[model samples]
Target chain A: MTTFRQFMSSSSLSTVKDAGTSAIDSLKKAKSDPSKPPRYSAAGLLVKGAKSEEWPRVWREHDLKKSYDVVIIGGGVHGLATAYYLATNHGITNVAVLDKAYLGSGGSGRNTAIVRSNYLTPEGVAFYDRSLSLYNTMSSDLNLNVMFSERGHMTLAHTDSALRTMRWRAEVNKLQNINSSVIDPQEVKKLAPSLDVSPNTRYPIQGALYHPPGGTIRHDAVVWGYARGADHRGVEMHQQTEVLDIMVEGGEGPDGKGRGGKVTGVKTNRGDISAPIVVNCTAGWATLISDMAGVKLPINTHPLQAAVTEPVKVFLPTVVVSGSLHVYVSQTDRGELVFGASVDPFATYSMKGSLEFTEELAGHVLELMPNIGRMRLLRQWAGLCDMTPDYSPVMGFTPVEGFLCDVGWGTYGFKAGPVSGEQMAECIATQAVPKLIAPFELARFERGDLVGEKGAAAVGH
Target chain B: MFGTRSFSFSFERSALMMLVPCPHCGPRNNSDLRYVGESHARPDPNAVTPEEWRAYLYWEDNPAGSLRETWYCRAGCRQYFTVTRNTATNEFENHPLPGNKTGAVDPSFHYVSSSVSPSVPTTSNAAQETETNS
Candidate 1:
């Protein structure tokens, strides 16, 4: 089930380690260098960094582009995060974050923020676990409570093959020192308590795959924290600055210029702004932005939707996932039940929620937890997702000079807000892309070396 | 073990004389999830001769007694599970087997191999972390 990181208490996180009893030490260990890496059973280790400042009123400016060392296109979490990481980690001062809309108003804001490290592939489990580890201490490091919850994550399997696949995944997770286990029907009842797993069904509650270090996070705080940090480090954040057309002078290799002149810059609604470096963090609109630069991106623009229900007494304590059901649900901090499902079958730019989705979601959720039938939905909305065939984000450099991309995050971009931004910043400052982000390069798709993250990326939690 | 050919088992004939291993979810009342008589299994791939191939393909035994056959829970579990069905009575029962229990039914009603695991820990917690599911 799709869930918000609303109820991932620190106490629940402590359960995976020395048995979830005390998290004070874990929290402390997270803030400083531990004798051992932050002992996260999720998937990877956690490293805490300092909190950054906010970009106040950066969203309302209608002014055009100003010159900068690096100008990142897209003011969402990834753009802001890229700015924050560039300023704090790399110390490259003159950076600008441009957004077409208000900050965090895109997929980054509309997503159901659940973070977990339970992945089937080694590369996947390792990468996401690192992000989960960072999230644990992100609030403190950023000096804000991003509400890093480590409640736990569960993947319920109905069929025996599905259950066996769960078992296989659990074993692989354990081999990496990631905590995951097999649970039977009785255990499933104890974890969710409200799940309907009558063994008499076709796909009975044979087992579940559990990750103790899995949980949720606050999506807005992540955007805010990075923006604040980047702003503090003298990064100019320009919101509502829509790039109308990109002017790339035709040239040879990275030295091409248009109209027999050197490369100029982008013409935004506000005015023309020239910059050497432009990072496409436009997210769902990434393809459009890339096309402006005369580059064809390996991404398809698709819309993903999520919804919330009127706040009720908080009943969901942990994040739940049903791969078979294709429905993931969790209750938010203020008691609103958050629901998310796979992207609609068709790809469009519209954000209108559909009734067909509501019917399908209600049916699946009711089957899992029959008791919540009394609740009513509060609202539903959709966001654009630049999807890739392999389901991995398109990061790193492009064929165009000074143009970088942090787009094509699919639906899992929200939870990876901090990490992706942090890494993108490093790439910008050093002018050297990190190898970790190397696997997700646009070149991978062309070369067929794509790092397939479909196993861990389907649910954006 | 997963990429092999087809399997066989005792199939219960419904009131309409349908078979047992048809693909109907338990709740679907009107679906033809079964067929009358028993499903057949192929001979060992290691065996030689056209006769062996024919025997594995179309041969059958009429031991309508406690018949032991290969059962594929396609619609239900989508996994290969062992089951003992009374040939004469056409009753179905499921049992776990070690490795690939292709035809070990007549001699053994229980899990007869050493590979049936009690608690082999995997990386991803099969969610059944507690003892109740065991």
Candidate 2:
């Protein structure tokens, strides 16, 4: 049997003498006198402006401690929001969020910022509806203007099969107390005068699933708000801190490969930080991060490309999506039309934008609205998505003790960020999976109890 | 508000357009092929447990670096073959040739003869021609 000293030396954690003792003392001191960040309000802004005083930084930087009670990998919206909720709801402030890059550098800022809860499954609809409600009051709760625009969202159905699926989704959404309905082509054209409802088009609009509560929000502001809130509550946010490997102790894993073990700590580039619990919130690198803990996840990374056009007059009033065409479009507050498509045809981690994506997107956008032919695309980019076989996320506890995963959030991760963070925070605090997210357990795949959401989540984001 | 200015449409060449090379057919666009994700060894059905069976069906070794995957030439030859591709850079290595069948077959893949069309030139004919020439 390998001794603890021998295991530490075998790994890259030999430099540390005592892992959590000194850090726990410092964390206790920080908890005793938690310094709150300055609040954002119109009165406070005017006072600062009148006094000619510079505003303080949104979040302060801190030195990496030797240990934390909870270590959340990935500093995106989900991780930051989890940290925020953990501090506020559970009063667990000894949490650290680590990121390989700056906060919101991943899918959090890369998504098209569309938020809706009209889903095909009851569980999916209920979960995402909670997220939408959180987003509705986020401006006052976070003291940051997320700039949420509740412009109605419309998902067009081009074929009879697609219309039937939309009706099914509408029924499911209604049963869950969500405001969704199936509208005809006349209603779709009335809602958005820009769309072509004529019969001469290649894919004529049959009907649409319209959700009046859906719209877009400022994605960066959401990330910043969560980071600021978490920091104010004594949660540490470490940027450019990459986790190299995870240290696990006993328990025989599946296939006897030593996977089902207790997570002791994670080794990073800076040094080894021992923590009792580690949460994997990384989207594109979900499988890789979990694999470091000897936990295999059913996830494949694929790049989803999105493009934005030059600023023009705001012609689109509502968010329009076409599942048959595999494209979704909405005009931002700046009048720039943001467009996103389905995940790429294959699994890849590369975020490099492809010419084929822009070409296909342009053709489809013009097919839906031929009047926008003169609109030139300003820029295009891609974000990595962790796609699962069932098109839903995998949350809650794994076989490995103290290693929780909130991943497998394919194309629709951004919309579910707030609720995922809330549920995951409750799970960490209570040491049990919450009832809302219990259906998304990693063991569901083994039991063939997958929550299939492909019809609503494919290109509907 | 339509202007009379002629629109000169041109995109930068930096954007990637994947070109896949098939052994039977020459180079074709990636759209012409169906991407089968990372290949895995199938365990025996009779002996495999439910956990192992589900893991085999869903789990993937989705590395950011070089990965060996299978692709089907749907538009060209309609044949399934394996190739090593770099997921990060979108680069391919060890391009399969017509006569060379040494490293192409994966241990998990079972070769089916009925899938191949007789009208198309088979790899055996190309190997026989190389043997005669040599």
lDDT (Cα, tens digit) per residue for candidate 1, span A77-155: 8888888777778788677777777778788788888887677777666667777777888877765568877888888
Weakest lDDT window of 10 consecutive positions for candidate 2 chain B? B125-134
Q: lDDT of all predictions, in order shown? A: 0.63, 0.81
| Local accuracy of candidate 2 as per-residue lDDT tens digits, A311-428 | 9988899999998787899999999999988777777776767677898899989999999999999999988899888889999999889899999999888999999999999999
Question: Candidate 2, which segments miss by more than 4 Å at Cα?
Answer: A1-34, A253-258, A458-461, B1-16, B45-48, B99-134
Evaluated at residue A176, the lDDT of candidate 2 is: 91
For model 2, chain A alone compared with the true chain A gives a TM-score of 0.91
Question: Positional deviation of B6 in candidate 2, in angstroms?
Answer: 43
DockQ of each: 0.01, 0.24
Which candidate number would show the highest lDDT if scored against the true structure?
2
CA lDDT of A133 in candidate 1? 75
